[model samples]
Target: MKHAPRLTALLLTLALLAGLLPAASAAAPQPAEPRIAADSAIVIDYDTGETLYEKDADTMRVPASMTKVMTAYIIFEELEAGNLTLDTLVPISDFAAQISRNQARYPTAVPLPYGGSLTVDTLLRLILIPSASASCVAMAEYISGTEAAFVQRMNATAQRLGMTAQYQNCHGAHVHYLTARSQAILVREFIRRFPQILDYTSATSATFNGTTYPNTNQLLPGLAFEYEGADGFKTGTINAAGYCLSATAKRDGRRIISVVMHSDNNTTRHTDSTALLDYGFARLAADAPYTDTAFHWSWQAVEELDALGAELHPSGEQFRPEQAVTRAEFTAMLYSALAADGQLPPLPGPEESTQPAETAPPEDTAGEPEQPAPEPEPPFADIDGHWAQAYIEEAAALGLVEGDQYGRFNPDSALTRQDMMVLVDNFVELPEANGLGFDDDGDIALWALEAAARTTAAGLFGGSGGRLFPSASATRAEAAQVVSRVLELA
Candidate 1:
């Protein structure tokens, strides 16, 4: 009997040790280090001012058009101080038009005929969006009466922002030198003081005087290589500078700024920037403590859900954390969350066409009978009489959801993690996933990679046992937690 007891104790000890080994090994998987084709690159966390990654960040190089970022910063400051207004019309001088003619070299210039009038807002858009050198001069002259005088203000502003750079002109057309570190600093402050610059930089195309000019930065909407959350910043290239880009993106609640200078080519500049952003996000995730503790995780999620007014279950008294969520249910939950956050647009009221009282005919035709308007068709085939009909319609209208190829909205089907990511991305701007590769990246569908990478970086989703179960069904509890987080952030 003594021998039997000793053997049993040894077997239990072995089993416990065996279980510990896998967990210990899986505790902290190392993230891949980022590499860039640029001669200089830097990535920083916007919230914490932490340097997530850098490569020769302080080496001086020709900044090219990126100098306009600083110029716009000054312009925004003046606007905020009430010294300049968006509607202030600036006269395009002969000198400005002549310099703008240098567009043959840059190919991003908007025509600025001498004596043509443009609002300050239009000129700023031309400078930031299309990289028109003439607009830079016009803005400088409008602010300081001459480009030389404007260059003085640029230098002064750069000094105030702690940017150690040599400026040779109002626009970045001359031999001006700026380090990646200095450029990032200038851009960070620009965004911090005037976050609305993103509205201009994020534009894929801007129209002035009926002529539409495409933005030089290709990482925006309607571009060849649009990154999900890329909103603002700039891109530049000169023979001497090669190619350069300063980019910023926000995901979840975290924002990252990346600068890549002296890339070998235009494609390489964008690629390097994307890689740096991925590395920054990966580092943030790796540094954060594991948030998957059993009871604590559930409790935290419950608090958010309660605050967001999320219902636990339809009939069950206990919250069934493992129950899968259907498409209709998830859409309703997301719609409710957006409504609670006041993020949804105002609903359209009854129009004159729909209301006979508002469209009453004159007294001479008062006796004529009013014809009833035909009912509009529902957006989805299967959602016509569904309980979640309104939610599905609103979601579809906002481009948040799409029906199957056969035009049938399968409302009862379970929602997959990949599908959820795609839906969430339509509402929230997601970060690029260039450098962050998962162990099971092959399992992710081609269409879902961008959303998965973004949601992962935002800390909204994570893989199970080092594998992202892209096709796995999302449970009701998980849906509640995600919706709550989105609302809280909003």
Candidate 2:
């Protein structure tokens, strides 16, 4: 929570940039780049590894927590190899626990209760979200029996990825004399090894157990150069590393990777990442075969006319795939698609729009045509009377709302840390939140698992009852508490 001040500063930076820029100016900033605080920066097309821009990129500097990106890659590979699964719980070793409790320059492990058990999936979430040092130590120990072995694995992976200038220590804490060139090479090597991980770095915000913590890398959000293609990588901070980031984004079927190290603060890290992403996308735009759309739909649009309540039509025919989509339209389309897919009930007709207050039929019902079945109650109505209902509706219209079993939004329900996570997860695209965290598994409710992970990661919610009560309703007070935190981080 102490990061509030830093987050505020970052928002101010974003606002100033937005106010000064024009929509048509998504192009990369000009060569007269502002005098920035970064020690190193580089941008390359992920598709061809072509260097788009570089400034002291080859100089070696502290890798800082950006080292976790490599650590995560190793963990992911192990998971893919069947060496690990979300359910594999690991105990905290003395050394790992020490790291977890160690209040290094960054906050220590989010106070994981001593000797507590956590799953590999959850461990990764903690590592990616808060850059929880203990989570990393615990994970390394779990995988290799010791941090030493884990470091060995990290260095081995580095060699395989062609990070010739890079090396590693047991804990990823910065060490002596790692040059900026070495850091850039390490980042390039990482991109070559786990090209798909861009998804994690670009996440704007995530929730873990109802607590939300935003990605320190501001570029993922539209705040930085309108990064429509931006998705993920990682962010880091330490006197040794300053502020560091490895960012990845896609556009027009092309992908680009950018790395910045030793930046001043939230402002510099954000601006540097933006400049790199901008430069990368600019090259692709110039090389495009023609004017291209930034977005397109993969699923067909459903258009209901009658008993054909569940209908599917080609995206281009029934709905223009090329047309930009509003949040409301997108959500409605999603709900309609789910209905067609049997995931949700059909939309209510005018005659069936309202539910009767009483369950039993009226006394005169015998003489009347059988009443049309009541339309499903709108989930959001339950909270209409709740304070902040307007804000909730705004979130819902943006597809940021969550619902209960009976399809009620339950606005008055007291929000858990996990609920906040679920809400943020869907509203923003963040790969790091996907199936990450100890409490997230098949047996757990999908919404709960997602919410717990995202909110926890985003620093919004903390779990209650040893688990996330996703079905629980949220109270106005509780919702405001969490929403205020989110807005702060945002």
Which ten residues in a row are the worst by lDDT in model 2?
1-10
Alpha carbon lDDT of each predicted model: 0.74, 0.55
Cα RMSDs, all models? 24.4, 21.5
| Candidate 1 weakest lDDT stretch, 10 residues | 1-10
TM-score of each: 0.55, 0.49
Q: Where is model 2 more than 4 Å wrong at Cα?
A: 1-37, 105-108, 176-199, 206-210, 222-226, 288-490
Clashing pairs in 1: none
Candidate 2 per-residue lDDT, tens place, 415-485, comes to 44344455545544444554334443344565466555655666565545545445444432244234334
- Cα deviation at 333, candidate 2, in Å, is 40
Cα deviation in Å at residue 321, candidate 1? 16
Model 1 lDDT per residue over 1-490, tens place = 0011111111122233222221111223547878788999999978667788899998889989998898888899899999989998888898787777776654466778887878999888888887887888888888889888888888888888787788878667667898999999988888888988988888887887688878878877668768878887898877788899999887665678999999998899988888888888777665432322122334345445445554333432244556798888787777656655557554433334754465765567676899896666666789888877766765665556778898888998999988888777776755665423668778889998887777777777766777777898998778877877676655
Can you tell me which runs of candidate 1 are displaced by over 4 Å? 1-30, 104-107, 291-490
